[model samples]
Target: MGILNKFLEKTKICVIAEKYSVAVEYAKALGCSKKDTYFEGDKYVILWTNGHICTLYQPEDYDEKFKIWKVEDLPIIPNGFWIKVRPGKGQILNSIKKIIERQEITAVCIATDSAREGNLIGEYTLMAIENKKNVYRAMINALNEKEIKAGFKNMKEDKYYKNMTLAAQARDEIDWLLGTNLSRAYSVIYGKKYYVGRCKTVLLNLLCKREEEINNFKQSLSYGVITKFKNDNCEYAGRLNYALKSESEARSIVKDICNKQGKIDSIDRDIKSIEPESLYNLNDLIRAVNRRYGYAADEVYDIAQKLYEEHKLISYARTDSRYIKKSMINDVKLIVNCINIDKFSMKKSDINNIERFIKRCVNDEKVIEHTAIIPLEVESLEEKYKLLSTKEKNVYDVIVENFLNNFLENYEYESIAFLTKVENYTFITRQNKVITHGWKERKKQDKNIVEVKEGEYVNVEDSVVEKKLSKPKERYTDDTLFEVLENPAKFVEDTKLKKILRESGIGTNATRALLLKDLIINGYVTRQQKYIIPTIPGIELVKDIRTDKLLEPFFTAVIEQQLQQIQDGELDKDELIKDTIKFLERHIEELKSIVIPDKNNDPIGKCPICKRGNIVRAKDKGYGCTNLKSTGCRFFISKEILGTYIDEKQVKNLIEEKQTDVLRFKGSKGEFSARIIWNGNKTQFKKF
Candidate 1:
């Protein structure tokens, strides 16, 4: 008997949270006291529901109404949808219901996380089982045990989360209603698998637009003048952007400029060093890790999720806040001190000095509920670090090292720019040098310089006029791609649409990385080195939808606004879904009228299997299919479903010679391996 049950004798309560651990954590805090606890004395019981114990029943689950995408079903809306304990979670549901049936239980307390999903979990569970018990809700933002206990101590009526529940219900039913209908409609019409969600479709369009930019890129030529001059001890290089039509013209100008005395027209210098970076948000961390190491966003997400859930070193890895909360200041300092002691081996006095400096820099207003990602405890991180693979270890090092440096002193640097003018030619040189290494002292940093201003006369040592060609537009890496996705205005020229995109979370942090991987795996894009380049099919898809709003970033942004409204209590979720449906209907009709070709017609390639048909790529599978016979030969190569990218050359080799030149691949189960060739068939694996 907990303390709360005695004070509120007739009330029953339930604790629902996003994860089992969260619910259990909150429950422990309250139940620790016997008698008069939140529920025991009140004759209340705490029932827990897993995250999304029930979802809007699938379309096929509603038979006769299925496969028809018409407005007559306008709200083909269910008066109420059927709910069941998720098929595999019978044990959990049974346990909850068993507690609910207890003799003394009189009221229900809803202690879910204060989020949309949390509300839905409790609501659907009650409705499904036909439990009409009186319910009260308790909401709190933090996951700490103290906060949980306090929230129970000062409980709010369940009616407080009613609107939130409505919002969640709306989101679920709408996604079910719109996603199912549109997906079916398109899949039927196009005879291909396609899926669209309020947010995911917009993300797809963003990628398609990027592919368009890359494919349509036209390379051009431009000229720059480079000169190498020697001073007393060293040689320096400077470049002049002298617009010239040809290399010969550029060389002629260089010759004329070098002949005259080079005088320093202007010398500008400023010295400053970069400070250590603050903690990273999910996006910032993803971008940095992607650039510094070739860690894919999805791979990094996996690493981060592990760091949070399994290792328990980082707090809530999916957050967007880059600043730590005021309450976390002391904890942050302690972490910094521990890192300096364990990893960097700084003396206690030095650690204390750095800690004081870090403490001084703390600001409360900058943080939200959760702080930027830093290790909660060094032991957890170090233990996990030892078990990680080489790739995972490198990424972990980035986070650990960054955590160490965030508390360190600032770096100082000197920057100098000298301008020289000779016979109508302007030469510019810029140089930057480190004055105080600061953070750079611990980590090697890359720098480039382009000037030497020792004395008056500039010495010319060497000169070259090489022909230069324009470069194609760059492709998306998991890093740069999000910038374009999250803030489309930066890449787009449309003024109105950009404003709309800025307000929406282009892709939720949880889903953004997976979407990138999907685009590459689907033959919509290809990876060249570390870059994500679009394929021919992707280019064609973009061309087909170039002018459609459904294919643009703004579409996703608008939906995001509605989602936010749902969260903010400004809009009912059902209305948002209805609006989304109506919007999609109009959009899909317009899209159907446009002339879009079949998959094969986009950019047909010779089939490597039969040499009689074309190769086709689809969502679930990619293979060479011969349309000549009723049953065609399907030589399929899955997109990372089974293995890494198997290119056209590999496909060609696989079929023509019956052996695939020892197909090397990263194993889904273990390390890298290759298929050994034997008598034109596959044989044993050779380990790497």
Candidate 2:
């Protein structure tokens, strides 16, 4: 009876949050009683982790040899990866396991941050459970009382999040495989800890490319002839249709057209409309904050997290999707009414006009995991604004405007493409007339307006030459870098690669800022005010390395997309791993070509499977790797296998070409000719 009573106590559901504060909100909304380190009610229990309690093991954790950097270890590709409890985090993981093991704890519901990384933490922590238990997912996008209740009411089976888990795992492994091997290879070659990364390498290369553009830029002067012409409506300036490289040429044209009779050859008028931009994904919000208030990407993320997790002021941060769900229309209605329109320069009338614009933001198909970041309907929202830090306020305003921009009407304008003929020269004049200020009025007080008519004769009042100088490409600020990562197609050249990158951005937006931060910490780049300038070491490192495929943004971005494909079950993770290994092999070859000094003299070159190992002859004992003794590498070729004699040149062929030319051998069945090859394992033979 006593055991049964304890088992009955397990009827309560468990909640796990990414942080204590979010867990507190979950507990409060569920009416749970506070415990020492958790909250418990008759039907619920809440637990939390300080972000992540477990993480993927480092390279050194796999083998002690990896602890010391060696160029000979050009690429360390693990057959399998492992995850362990983060250091100093074992206690919390223990507590979570203990709580989950209780008899009455019927099911577990993950309430971690709604993201790929958070899914990893939740699933990985649960690996500690000794027995199977029912699992659910609590998708709380906001920590408000209403959202928390709704999240619990709509709990889903944990299997629903399998894709998220897979994506995070794939990304982690990719990073580990690339970062560990490449960092070691470059650091050893460059004689410094270069600390290469999957994403940061591309980012560093972008900076270096930009630096080269600036250094190599040659400022040249060009001139154009401008003439002032008057019609009945107004006098306007028109430029010649062509550019002149010399001032004398521009002046000659100007002198010829001066005081000349001219007629408007033709004028084309058309009305054009520009729709408002989509709402705020975390990346979009970060870019906006950086542009307006100059906050770093990480800082904006921190503030946004605080808003979503603590203040209950915004939707989930770190989302890549920009469209709110069509089902969330009610939530949208609630939020717009709750915010202070007066502060955002929005009128009560504008709120009424939001009906049509609201349709543009709602799309069930576009919303993936979470909707765009949006302000929530909270009490004292206006008062909350006044108390926020200056930077916080700036970020909040951009997020709010991102949503509000939808409420405003589309900006409409009329453009006139006018052409005037002077002698044999054709002068072009273009003007924009504002048809509807719409959203434009919210930002600008003045709209440049000019009206023109076709076939109108006019006299040239004056003509002069105008000189212009081209400017070098601008350096990347946090805003522009965020944009580049989201849309690298503009910079990338390959059509297929660019298309893939366009669909799946260069890196995960949630982690881009953190990776950028690592660049500075590792002495690759520096933040000069708004610019991410590459250091001398940074520039040299990019130039010195020759891992062409690994250095491309398209490679990293496509890997990111493949992770998504893995999540969607469209691609198998194991297959992705196998493909990655093949690519890693190629990348390692590229690194070795640049003289990754051999640490040992095994003569026959490096092992194709275990890249660090060297092949050597045991004096008529055939050939095997030197690392076979230390690392248990399985690489060997018997001098006489199946009545076939393997020679020195054959051993070199096996090492370099991964195979030896077909030779006669005696098998159990009959005499056969086959190629001795490293069949991804011990010695084997393949017949053609």
Candidate 3:
């Protein structure tokens, strides 16, 4: 009776959050005012953890022999993956451990972000502590007070989320195995640092393929006849249907139509309507921001995350679903009512229609894990407006406009196509005239009107032949690259494989941006303004290591499909890991059999410091000494000086003559000229 009384007397519940900002919101929602690193209440204790409190063991942690990179030790597959507390997180881990072991604590509720990664955060933390207690999960999309309270009320048992944790663990382990072993193998064989991943390698390959296409493109000139017709005081231009291969052919066609009157063969007018676009998933949001503002995909992601966590202005930002659950209608209404559109001078009718407009965004089946990124119910933006940075304000405006567009009507326009006959040639002219501005007021489209009647005769005011050149496809921008990453079916040829690749892209919405960023950081891709181009080393890396199974989109899709099955509990985790090991073994053997080409052996010039060793082109437009591994010679020179890539010929001259001619470079202030000189130990730029 005494023991029962003591056990029943403990009413404390601990809430573990994934982040401090989230913990603060949980504390507020739970009515805990007093604060420290953790909040202590009469009945509840709220503690927070940084993003990940624990991580998988590295290669060195498994065995000391694996520390050296060698082809003989090709594949390093662990029998059982282990987790350790992340460095700098030991104190928090200990705190959580002590709290979980406390007799006063009766239960624990995981308040991490509602996703697979979030599940892993909570699971790993618990695993680090080796806790076997009553645990529950709080699944909520937003960290607002109402959602938090409701999530607590509808908390689920931890068993329901076990599969999510398993899937996350499988992903981590597989990534570690592939990344570590392949990276070591390629680095050792090629004598250069090579980072590899399932998604990142695919991304690098895509960039290299695009660069090749651009490099191999050939421009051909063609000529077209442009005829201007005047009818009913309106002048319109029309082009001939055929493009002539030579200037003489185009001139002959223009001469034939010079003095002729064009008869309108037909005039077709149709009303066309464009519906509002669907709400933003993370990928959609990233692409839109990149297209509109030229922001990097990772930069846009960071801005969205900041909006979600720091500003509390938006819902979960990492979601792939672009729809809201039916249950969130009232919450969406509240959010719509809380926004301040007075700055845009919107009318009351526009504001009142928002309630009905948000209904179109609700579809229960479309929601998975979380809903689309939507604004939260905050009061007028007058107070918080000052707190937002320029980029934050831009992102907030985009979300607001997308939400506001739902209440507006479709953009209606009349498409008019006029066919005119001049001598023996028929020309077509098309124009669009706006019937209703509708949602297009946010982004206005061009309004063109051409007044013409069927069977009307018009005078040809002028005729000219214009020479034009065929242009190759533009380089991949961040927006286009993300689009391709999301749906790569256009790149795949096989029907069944394309379908599979379309269903499961190279990476998830939450990870695609990170993968692209990693490619840039690994020296596999370079950012030229808005375009992403592969460097020489990047191109060679993809060309050398590509195999039937490795660095292919279909392989990634298959892995993603298996991961989905694991999440759905249709596949066992152990079986998946076992099959992955087998796959890795086969690939490792094949990789070892192939002879890696030595592309980095070409000497650029003699090293100034080492004297005996030659300098060769290194990664990221730099030069390095061939004797780097021996004699500890660190002789190197950057190819880019003050935001300019020095010409190869100029670098060679600098090496041979100690000084090169003056070169122009763009600086932060303005353009300036400088001479590059090798001063015995290093290269320096002297301003002229």
Candidate 4:
């Protein structure tokens, strides 16, 4: 029995929210006469909806609409977007419907977060249930007891959230109008399946644009010089390239100056102001985890999701804001105290500095609804600290330490720049040495800068004049994903729309991670080692439609503004949809005129079995012999072995040349050569 059941005897309410744990908490907050909500809280049943319980029908999902693409019937805006209980979700929806029809229930409370999507789900479910029960809204932002209890005491009528529902409905309608119609438009005009969606298209455009940069980038060779010195105890590292140009020149200089004593010509040292790092926004956290632990964006997301739903220690993990709400201030303090209670304590100086920094950043308006993800309570914090898996533990510590450091002192450090005189040449050396670690002392071992003293000639061991090259622009990673999402215009070279999309980029934080995953899975992009390299398909897609403004960030930024206007009631939703459709239709027609190479020409290699046909790659399944249908060639290859990725070139070599080039395998095993010999009949590796 939930709180609602205890209040209204024999009562039951169906909870529908995207987050399951939050839904269960809302049920308990409504009325908690029972313990163990998932197993025994029968009086108030809590249910959940994943991002969407239903989506607009894909063109093929519709009966005659499925067979072919036709522009005449398009801008094939459906009469009205119908919502079916998603397949496999029908039973759950029906169970909730049955609960709604029970005689003892006096009313239904729409228990969901206070957001546009939440309101849409409530309104849709109400319409679907057919039960005309009295309705109240239980809108809470956080799942913590205090917030949930406070929300129940101030439950509002469902009518108060009508605008939010309208907003969500408009969002769905826009995606349907754009995705379905444009997808069909491109398919008919270009004769290939090209997709477009409110957010998906913008994301695809981002990947395509980045692909262009990587492909066209020119790499130039350069050089740098490093100096070697050794004192009795310490070994230091310094770049000598600050003196000369080419690696050859630096090497010559180093050879001449090796026996000469270099004097510290001048030393400039100053206090460097270090502000505490901002709280972890979802993207920031994902980026950090990827950097620190080698977790992919999706992997970290899964861990965070598990921590949020299963462990119930963290708050919502989907938000972009790093600021926490004023109501959460005390809770934040408690969490900080819990982490630092006995294990760690701040020095008085660090305490003062951090307090000043916190005062500067902590503002009521900066946070909305809830703060950045933090533990729900002290007990939960302690429980999470003990129960987390090693990987989870690392992520948890990052959040906790950052949360604590936010309230600690600023890291005051001294940066020293010096000019050393060596053989009548002045060498520049810049060093950022920490004078006071302050908040950084929380993770002292991970400090990037070391302490240095004025007039001290520390040994810079292992000096070399290494030839270097000016590398091309690196591909997008989880970190760069946020950067693009934050300032997409930086890449576009557009003055007008760049200014508009500068704030909210191409898509919201909630959808950015998912969008990146989709691009990779759909073959638009892939990770080459650590780089998110765009495939031939991704590259050509952009090259084929470079002038199409719809493929640019500025266009999406304009759409975002229009969407905001609709949400704010300043612009009509129908009018906005009409304008978006017109823009997309124009782009689709233009792109249709552009030629795209048949994707089949970009081959993995000739089929190993057929010897005359090509090999093709498919998602889930790897490369397959494309001659399978005509000549019964059914050979295929695996994409990875153990955890290491084997590239397409290697695959091609194994099938065409019968050997992979010499490679170094990590382990005591050393360098080896892999070969698929005897006409692809056997695989073997021998030491090189």
As a whole number from 0 to 100, the lDDT of residue 622 in candidate 3 is: 76
The residue-by-residue lDDT of candidate 3 on 45-148, one tens digit each, is 88989889999988778888878888898798776888898889999999898888888887788889888888889989998898888888988788778888
Residues 1-688, candidate 2, lDDT per residue (tens digit)? Answer: 2212333543887788889998888889999978988999987889998878878788788889878887676578766777788889989988898898888788788888777888888888887555378788878777789888888888788888898788888888877787778778777766666777778878888887876665445566789988999867778889999888999998888888878889889888899998777888988888888888888888888898887777778888889888887778887777877877476655435656646755788787888888888888888888887778877777787788778778877889887788999899999988777777666544555445556667778899999889987666777899998898888888767899889989987777788888888888887788766777777567667876686665678888778888988888898888888887788788777766675443234467777768897787655356778888799987777766664445567878877787887665546775455787776666677863
lDDT value for candidate 4? Answer: 0.63
Candidate 3 has its poorest 10 consecutive residues by lDDT at 1-10
Model 4 C-alpha lDDT per residue in residues 1-688, reported as the tens digit of each score: 1345345656655556666666666666656443332312545556565545555566666568556777766656565566666677666567667666768766667766566666777777767666598777776655667777777666666676565577678777777777677667666666656655556656666765655454344545567766755465444455653444566777777677676656556778899878766887777788878777767777788788777666766777766677765555666556554563334455322454334534754667866544676655646455556777988877776676666666665687677776655666566666676666667764535435434444555433445676765544555677676667767777666677667877667776666777778877877677755556555555545544434555767766776677667666777777877786777667656655666665544788777666788877654345677787888876777554322245567777777777765432323442122333425654566433
Q: What TM-score, over all chains together, does every model reach? A: 0.73, 0.81, 0.86, 0.76
Ranking under lDDT, best-scoring first? 3, 2, 4, 1
Write down the lDDT of every candidate, Cα atoms only. Answer: 0.60, 0.78, 0.80, 0.63
Question: Number of backbone collisions per candidate, in order?
Answer: 32, 4, 0, 12
The number of the candidate with the highest TM-score is: 3
The sequence of per-residue lDDT tens digits that candidate 1 reaches over residues 27-87 is 5666622322122323334445556676666654666665555433433445566666677
Query: Which portions of model 3 miss their true places by more than 4 Å?
Result: 1-9, 34-36, 343-348, 351-359, 442-448, 597-688
What's the CA RMSD for each of the models?
8.6, 16.5, 6.8, 7.1
Worst 10 residues of 1 by lDDT: 32-41
In terms of lDDT, which candidate is stronger, 2 or 3?
3
Give the per-residue Cα lDDT of candidate 4 at 652. 76
Question: Which is the better candidate, 2 or 4, if ranked by lDDT?
Answer: 2
